[model samples]
Target chain A: MATIETTGLTKSFGDVHAVEDLDLTVEEGEIFGFLGPNGAGKSTTINLLLDFIRPTSGNIEVLGIDAQERPAAVRRRVGVLPEGFGFDDPLLGREYLEWAIETKEADDDPDELIDLVGLTGDADRLAADYSTGMQQRLAFAMALAGDPDLLILDEPSTGLDPNGIQNMREIVREQAERGTTVFFSSHHLAEVEAVCDRVGVMNEGELVAVDTIEGLRESAGGPATIQLECATPPTELGVADLDVVTDVAVDERTLSVTCTGASAKVDVVTHVAERAEIVDILSESVSLEALFNDLTDGGRDGDDADSEQAATEVAQ
Target chain B: MSVRTVAKQDFLSARRSRALWFATTLFALLAVLIAYGSQGYRLSATEQVQNTFRSFGMVLAVLLPIVALVASYMSIAGERESGGIKFLLSFPNTRRDVFLGKLASRLAVVAAGLTFIFLAATAVAVARHGAFPVGVVLGTYLVSLLYGSVFVAVAVALSSAVGARSRAIGAAVGSYFVLIVLYLVPTIRITALVQWVHDTMLGMEPNPHLYDAVTYTSPYIAFRKALNLVLPTEMQQEVFRGSLEAGGELPVYLTDEFSLVVFAVWLTVPLVVGYVRFEGSDLE
Candidate 1:
């Protein structure tokens, strides 16, 4: 079953369309990464899903329940960690978690959840006194209190050290293993690449692509590059005849073949080994960071042109 | 249950605010001082208690609204500013829960403070004079509570209407000045000026009934008139004899029941407006 689904969702703040014609779906028990730049409408989409804001048009469903019609029911089963969230009260971390537990009507131990988020010693201190990283950890613990069926974390790793980020990744993996649907938004491409089963890249209020990391890499442009070091240079290797090999370059005894997919790597290796002895081979796949930049930068130029045209029309 | 939970949280935060504690203490001290000072005068017990009620009513007419504004001006606006509303709404609670919870909690704080001061004043009055009128004291306290609630509702409504903390603070203070100071002060001055002009220049008497109706538009004045009905009949005559003599009788519209209804309107209208505005907003 889909944990979250939205169809043609649109939200506009006057002339600025914050989210436009968004269609999305997240299956149960999958870690779906929502990636976008600062103003690409990631938060707006999440807000619509949580029913924090009413949509200008379209429908949203969470756990098969219409979110707009029954937000409280959806909220009861979903945990959210909103961006820029702060504790204005002088409540201790443990007390805040306990409040969240009561709010969710769950029996989870606050102390245990605090420890899980690496906020053990800081649980008794006032949350107002916590540093940004500590506050993030405490909020994560609160979100984990109810054993929720769905988790929506917006920029959950905004303020965290490397060790804290590692702990967050482990917790996300653990939750996904427990069949909890995890939908999170982040600018940290590497983190999303590590844990996300599927990723949706949004730009200018629209989703550009949604696919697995490897698939996104392929869609961005060519696949993995295989670098082979051979014992003898194969002068008679006509690799240009194969469709999988986009390009092949030979530098002394080293052969570099760019394949369209993982399957092409073996074919190239076999063809090279038939002519020359293969010593070592190295494959380098495209990083999500590079693919994300490629996709968003392209989208940004288009957005700039559209806005410029709008500005000209207004002037006229 | 959600409303209670939100209210409890707000109450706990209010308890931690040093400003609220300071306001409550100052009000209590002032009440005690007034109660003790009245005892020095050589008068009957009824006169002493009536004096106490009159003096306390005057002080609370100014003091309670300020305290109520201070207690509630930041209730929703501060949460919205600090991005805490995001965390709160992410839970199972609705926006209506938050609005009602904040109103209930602020009302509780103001009521508790007023109750403390009234009780202290009663103790002082009982210790100085041999007897105290339970009916008048309770009546004054209840009416004062209702008056404070008007300002509390106004402050919370303004807080919800504005998006930022600074704007909410400005709105609350601005409304306070308009309703309490500007509205009441100018009405008195203008009425006196008009009456003087009519008598001296036109050689005619201004209608006292018209004067009472115009002045009674101020909630503070309406509250005072309502308190007059609760006091002893002799005290009512003492306070209102000039107006009664001028008009030959009080107008039907200027009755105690009408003032009570005015106070009720002051309480209900702002609260309903704030609730509806809060419900309609995007909360971002």
Candidate 2:
């Protein structure tokens, strides 16, 4: 069964459309990464799923239950780590975890959850006094309460050190291994690449692409490069003349070939080997960064400068 | 059941608030000192107790609302402003639970403060004269609890109506001025305006019952009138002579028990309206 499903979901703040025409589905136990830039409406869509904000028009189902009609029931089975949340003052970190456990009617030990987040000694201290990273860890432990069947994490890597980030990722993987569906949202490509089974890319309040990392690269048809170290300084040998190959550069005893698609790498290698002896060949597949840049608007640019440049172009 | 957990968590937070404790202590001390100071009037034990009730009721009418508003005005809005509402709603509890739980906690805090103040005042009267009116004091305390709950309801309702802390404070203080002071006081009572309109436009004599209708609508006035239920017969005449002097049998709704209904209405209407606004609006 699908853990989450949305149809024609839309949310608008007056004239600004924060999320528009969003249709999404996450299967049971799948780690689905929601990817976008800073202002891509990723948070807005997550808020809609949790029913923290009402949709302008559409439907959402979580764990096969209507999210809008019974949000608290859906949340009872799903744990959420929202973006930009603060702990209530005068509450200890351990108290927060215990409160989560009590509220969910779960029997998990708060001490064990505290140890999992590495806040054993600091759990008794007030959460208001904890540093940003410690607070993030505490929130993660709270979300782990009740052994929820679904986890919705928005920017889980916001204030984590490298070790903390790795710990969080491992915990997420462990939860997924327990057959818990995870909906992870982040702007960081590398983090998503590591754990996401499939990713959906959102841009300007619309979903632009949804596929596996390798599938996105393939479908994007981005540039792939191959380096050839020849027995001597090699000639182009009509490598650039081939329609698939985009650019060819020659250096001392090495020839580099850039191609637009996967087929071009084989064509370039065969063409080079027929003419000259190839000593060493290294090929690199396209990175998600490039595909992401292509899918989005050349990645995030300075808004002021981009608008000014656009204004000048319009004037011209 | 979820409301219990939310209320418990909220109460635990309120328990640690030094500001609430400080205000309770200050109010208790002031009430005791004022109750003892009224001894300068050479009076019998009964008169002394009546004097205490009169002075305490007057002070409570003015002070309890401030404490109740201070305790509750930020219950929802502060959490919303600090991004804490996200953490709260991320749990299984619904928005209704959050709203009602917050109301419960604020009421509990105000109830505790009122208990201390009333007990202190009663204890001082008993300690001074070695005996006091037990049933009357208990009845007065019950009515005072209802009165405090009315203000807490208004304050929490105001808190739920807005997202910003500044706006909540503004709304709360504004309501206080209009409901507590401007509706019954020397500045300009709503009844005075209505009486002026009655005399000028309708060209009629100033109707005393019309004044009673408009004046008793204020929670402050309703509280004072409700005290007539517990006050001795003579003291009741001294407090509520205006209606008695009207020289006609009063309407049933104008009775002291009817003011309880007024208290009930004030307690409920604001909360229902606030919850409707809260349930439909988006959280940040």
Candidate 3:
């Protein structure tokens, strides 16, 4: 079942269309990463799903309920850590967590949540005195109140050190393991690749791509590069003619071939072995960071084209 | 449930603030000063009690609204400006709940402060004069609470309507001047000036109803009229005669009942306007 779904979702502020014709879905129990550059409408889409801003046109459903029509019902089952959220400074961190527990009517012990977020020592201190990272941890713990079925985290890893990031990743994994659907947006490509089961890439208010990490690499034409160390360098090997081999280059004693997928690696090896005695082979795959940059760079070009058209219209 | 939770949070947070403490202390000090300070006049027991109530009421006409405004102006705008309202709204609470909850919590604080002031003044009055007018004191306290609520509602309404904290504070202060100071001080002078212009320049009879209308618009004057209902008839006539022609009766619209209605309207109008605007605007 889809935990979240949006159809033709759009939001505009006067002349600026912040989000346009966006359709997305996050299934139950999957860690879905919402990836985008700054101002790519990632936050806007989250706000729309949460009904913080009314959509110009679209339908949004969270936990199988129309969020705009029944936002309270949707909010009850979902815990959200909104981007740029501020804490009530005078309240102690423990007080904040207890309030969250009360507001959500959750039976979870606040102490356990404090421990989960590694804020046990500072929980009794005023939130105003907490460091940025400590505040983020407190917000994360609050988001876990009620053991919500869905967690919507926007920029959840922001203001965290490396250790905090690792702790956050572990909590997300644990939540997903407990059958909670996690929908998080972040600019941290590496972290998203580490935790998200499926990723959606949004660009310029449009969802340009959605797939598994490996699937995204494949769609970007980033194939695995395989290097073969041969007993004898073979000449005139038509590895390029093979369907799986995207490109092949021969260096003195080693032949390198790029293959489109995992299965293609086998075919390339077989084809190379037939020509030369294969002693050893090494393979490397492209990273999600490269794929994200590739996708957004392409998105930027589309934006440039759109602005050029707009400029010409103004001139006319 | 959500409204109550929001209100509880607001009340707890405000209870920890320094401003509430300062306001309460100031009100207590002023109450004692007004009751005991007037003992030097050597007036009778009834005169002493009436004088103390009038002096406290006059001070409250300026002081209580400032206290209420100080306590409440940041209630909604500060949260919205800091992005805390985003987390708040992420809960099951509606926008209307947030507005009402804030108003309700601040009202509790103001009511508590007013009660303390009233008790302090009453104690001083009884100890200094050997007597206290329970009916007048209670009535004055009730009217003062209503008057202070008008300012509290205005401050909260302005806070909710604006996004920036600095802007909200500016508006709240500006509104304090317009409602408490400008309406009370200038209406009397402006009314006199207009009457003079009509009598001298326009060669016409100055309209009496105009003066009544302008004066009653001031919440301070409305509170005074309401307090008159419980005072002795001699004192009531004495207070009115000072402000009106010696032989003329008070205007119909300036009746105690009408003043109460006006106070009620002052409390509701700003709050409703703020709630409606708050409900319609985006939280961002």
Candidate 4:
């Protein structure tokens, strides 16, 4: 069964369409990453799933329950680290964890959850006075209170350092290992790349792509570039028959080849070695960051006129 | 169960407030001072006790509402503005739990403060006069609590209805002006204006009962009127007492029973209005 599902979900604030016609589903025990840039409706979609805001039109179900009709019941089984949340009250870190436990009627120990989040030493301090990273860790501990079946983290690494972000990745991995489904949103491609089993990319309040990293690379069609320092440049390499090679160039003793897919690089290397003596091989794989930029940029440039038309229709 | 947990969390957090402690201590000190100063009256023991109670009640009428308002006006609105309520509602607790829990917590704080003040006053009276009017003190404490709850309900309702802390503060201070200050400070001018309009503009005879009705609309006045149910009859602060002594009957609306109803209205109406708004609003 799907842990979180939304069909045609949309939310608008006056003239602004924060989320539009969003359809999403995260299966149980799967770590699904939600990716988007700023104002791309990632957080707004999460908010709609959690029932923090009402949808303009559509349905949302979490844990197979209608979110809008019984939000508290949905939340009872789901743990959330909401975006832009703070500890304005004067409760200590442990106190907040304890409150979460008692509120959820869970039997988990507070100190253990604190230890899980690497906040054992800071659990006795006032949460309001903690640094931003410490507060994020505390919020994570609170969300882990009940060993909830599903965890929704919105920008969970907003204020973390490099080490803290690494720790967050490990904690998320550990939770998923315990058979918990994780739904996390982030603009950072590397963060999602490190832990997600599948990803959904959102742009302009609409879902642009949903696939595994490999599938995304395939659909994005980013090329792998291979450079060779050969013993000597050879003319007529006879590599023209290869389909994956997009381009090939040789200057003096150097040869550069651009191609798609992993095996194609090996194929190109073999083709080059058959014709000349090879010295050194240098290869560059496609980075998801560049792919992400391309995807979002394409959304903006390609759909500019379409979105304007939709806005006018909405206005009418 | 969720309501109780939310209430407990709110109360524990509120316990750290310096303002709550300061107000509690201040009221207790004032009670002690009133007890010591009232010893010079030459009346009988009962009369002197009644006189001291009247003076203390007057001070309490002003102080309790302000304390209640200040303590409660920021309960929901402040958290909403600071994005802390997102952390709260991220759990399984409903909006009703949050609203009623805050009301319960503020009511508990006000009740705890009243306990300190009344205990201090009773202790001093027992030490100085060698007497304790158990019924009177207890009754007066309950009445003060009801009055305090009225203001707390008003303030929490204001907090829940608005999205911003500044708006809540504006509403709270605005309510203080309209309900307490206007009734307490400019009584003579307001009364003269009402009388002039009633007699001159409308060309009608002056009705003192009209003044009583208008004044009693303020919770402060209604609270004072309700206290007559507990205090000695001679010491009761009843409106229209002069005309009643001259063979005029008091209107049912002016009776102490109706003031209790007024207290009831003030308590429930604001809560219902606030809950309706709070339940439907988006947390963003």
Higher-scoring candidate on TM-score, 1 or 3: 3
- Give candidate 3 misplaced runs (Cα > 4 Å): A222-224, A240-249, A258-267, A298-316, B40-42, B186-188, B192-206, B237-243, B246-251
Structural similarity of chain A in candidate 2, as TM-score: 0.92
lDDT of each: 0.83, 0.87, 0.83, 0.84
Q: Best candidate per lDDT, number?
A: 2
Candidate 1 at A202: error in angstroms? 0.8
Off by over 4 Å in 1: A222-224, A240-248, A258-271, A298-316, B39-42, B186-215, B237-249
Number of backbone collisions per candidate: 0, 0, 0, 0
TM-score of chain A of 3: 0.89
Fnat for every candidate = 0.68, 0.79, 0.66, 0.77
- Comparing 1 and 4 on lDDT, the stronger one: 4
Give lDDT: candidate 2, residue B245: 84
As a whole number from 0 to 100, the lDDT of residue B155 in candidate 2 is 94
User: Least accurate stretch of 10 residues (summed lDDT) in model 4 chain A?
Assistant: A307-316
Docking quality class, candidate 4: medium
> Model 3: DockQ against the native?
0.68
Candidate 2 lDDT, B28-136, residue by residue in tens: 9988987777663677886787678777887888988999999999999998998888888999989999999999999999998899888898888878876587767
> What's each prediction's TM-score?
0.90, 0.95, 0.91, 0.90
In model 1, the fraction of reference contacts reproduced equals 0.68
Alpha-carbon error at B267 in model 4, in Å?
0.7
Real interface contacts reproduced by model 2, as a fraction: 0.79
User: What is candidate 3's CA lDDT for residue A175?
Assistant: 98
